[model samples]
Target: MTTSATTNAAGVATERSSRRRGGLARPTGIPWILPALVVSVGVLYYCIGYTGYLSTLKWDGASPLQLQVGLENYARMFRDPIFWRALGNTALFYVVTFAVQVALGIVLACLLHSRLYLKTLYKVLIFVPVVLAPATTAPVFRQIYAPTGTLNTVLEGIGLGGLAQPWFSNGTFALFIIISVQIWQSTGVVFILYFAAIGQISPEVIEAARIDGAGDIRIITSIIWPSVRGTTIAIAILSAIGSLKTFDIPFLITSGGPTYATEFLGTRIYRISVQYSDVGLGAAFSIVLLLLAIGTAVLIQVGSRTREEKAGV
Candidate 1:
């Protein structure tokens, strides 16, 4: 009896030791994760802080760039008329492009979602432009819109030579052409996004609406629209930000021709920094554009969140 009791006591001692060890081994947050996050944040802070410092100085990017001038560059930026013009042009591009792209994307998405023939072929054709390099497309369109280009050639052939005014020859028309190219290049992306969003929608819900005598238009308006409202908002916000920073297409096609007609902030910064050899002012413009982008993004997020809350409540 004593032998059995001693054995049971030993077993209890082992169980207590194991429980103590298990309790001690429980995780108390990782050491490496916090340090890595700190390093990442520090690097980001340094980059932004350095840019801000550079914006205040009058650095020509040569011969002592660390010199400070106390906001002279920023002051000059405010007085620059070209900056204001670029800002206005950017705003106009964003508004017009966002409206047209979203409207056309929804229409196309709805059409392609149906049981149409050649659906795969249609999708491939539509998505082809989205994958092409923007640089290649810019020059291609330039040829198409040039004075003696295919567009004018086609118009002349149709005996509509009067309709073929210089598409990119003048200031007003150059901006218009740039916007047109942007619309053409970007519409495919919008279509693909909206098409995917629509496909995610439950077919049962759509069928139920149809069975209840709801027409296609009615079902789209009452059901699909609400379901994809988040995606629509997201697309609008993305288009707005993208339009503001439009550079390569405009630069390659128009080169800010006809007295700075296509002078967006991006192109303007490049001209000042590279062509005129003024680094400080260009840095200031870069800072301004970054702030504008951040502000617009935040506003979009806030507006979207408010709408979501209202819908939920």
Candidate 2:
């Protein structure tokens, strides 16, 4: 009996210890959150660090050290007039497009925010441009901008043939055509975002403004503008960033043509990396683009946060 009792006690103790060990094995803390973080860090390191490393090496698309010129690519970039032109063109596109996009988005959002017939249909139709693939749209616009294309046809029929010059051939006009296409394609996205933000404004707030003898214009300028300020800033930032990285439309429509008049940073990088086979220069340009993107993003965040805080106060 004594031997049997001792054996039973030992078995119970072992089972209790096993249960405790199992409970400990199941995660109770930060270890559970580590795998995702490790994966993210690894990805960031590979992309960023690898790019930086490549930028420092003079690779001729075939090998890493066919021509080892330390910082020559970067120095050459400073002396390249075409690079300056591309940078300036990108800035111009950003400024002009951002202004037009914001103005149009605000107007459209306000118009459609009201009771209208077939509101859903209007929304769908307007937002349809935003959903189309960029690649497909670019080539279609290219055809339209051709010398004897539909645009010139309409112009001729309207007795404005004198106004129809070669669209993509003229340096002055090429960037403008590209900008128009971009605005047409991108404004709908801004419209949807602003529209959603406007919907969140309380009807009661508008009613209160009405009771206070405020007109539509006054209400929008005072209440609506102030309320949607965050969204507006966000849209501006996004538009600027998008413009800086613009490649496809310009590449397809103008090919940064008419003497490099519309050569954006993105196109320049592609030319250097692919066309010229200057991997080092391309990598340097890529780094510049990356820095510009990050810096612009940071500025936007700071500006938006500041405005939000002031508005709150």
Candidate 3:
């Protein structure tokens, strides 16, 4: 009886192992990837298609009577002054943030890659802001820029009290504050990416440049810049997308206030959907935002590729 039981157990284990092998050795591999394929095609695209459908109707999110409005929402969006202002803000924000972050990130990354003192400490300091949540930091920024906050106090102590005023009350100043906050929070990510790209460079190539009497700036502009084109293109796409969907800091700090100066597509969408309870208008805005983000990324990528091909890069 004991011998017969051992033989049955061994046979069962062998059968299970062979079944596992057969599953992995399937030629098509369709079953292995079906879940992800379903998620992408089924869930993701279905939501997107549903949003497109919602954009064509006028509904208050919970109402059963969804009036078919066709393209009226899009037309209203185009004619809306606040929408234009938000679009302009996004454009300006993208340009300024992209330029400043690129310059600062590249310079800092290069310095850190060299024989700089306290490299590890500097790296930690630089990256800490990236990990900090915007929700937590937004209140801090609001207080600092408040009319009687630390900034004004410091200004008074330094005899620059004459320049101290309400920073967030003015439209232009509020927008500037938003831009500054974004740059502070996001530059660390840009720095890390540049640092990694720069690290991949061959030490021998940099040594050759040094031996050829190339200064730091010369080597950076010539060798390092061209080599990191891929990283820069990636950063550009990310910046474009982030700019299109800017909401957290602006909504928390300025609330897109001071006469809609800091309004963005994301903030507008939220206000329309929740505050106004116009889900259809919000859906239209969201659809446009999605298209713009995708289009901007494609334009940047294609433009970069075209330049590279033309220059034989």
| C-alpha TM-score for every candidate | 0.86, 0.86, 0.91
**Candidates 1 and 2: which is better by lDDT?**
1
Model 1 per-residue lDDT tens digits across residues 1-313: 9999999999999999999999899876767588887877788777777778888887778866467888999999999999999888889889888888888888899999998999999888877877888788988888898889999999999999999977887888889888888888888889988899999999999999999999988988998888788788889779878977888988999888778888899999999988988888988998899899889988998998997898883
> Which candidate should be chosen as best, given TM-score against the real structure?
3
Cα RMSD, model 3: 7.4
Clash count list over all predictions: 0, 0, 0
Q: Specify the poorest-scoring 10-residue window by lDDT in model 2.
A: 63-72
With a 3 Å backbone cut-off (N, CA, C), the pairs that clash in candidate 2 are none
Off by over 4 Å in 1: 1-45, 310-313
**lDDT of each prediction vs. the true structure?**
0.87, 0.86, 0.95
Give one digit per residue, the lDDT tens place, for model 3 in 152-228: 99999999999999998899999989999999999999999999999999999999999999999999999999989
Model 1: lDDT of residue 239: 82
CA error at residue 99 for candidate 1, angstroms: 1.1
- Candidate 1, residue 133: Cα displacement in angstroms equals 1.3
Look at candidate 1 and tell me the lDDT of residue 214. 100
Error of 2 at 44 (Å): 3.6
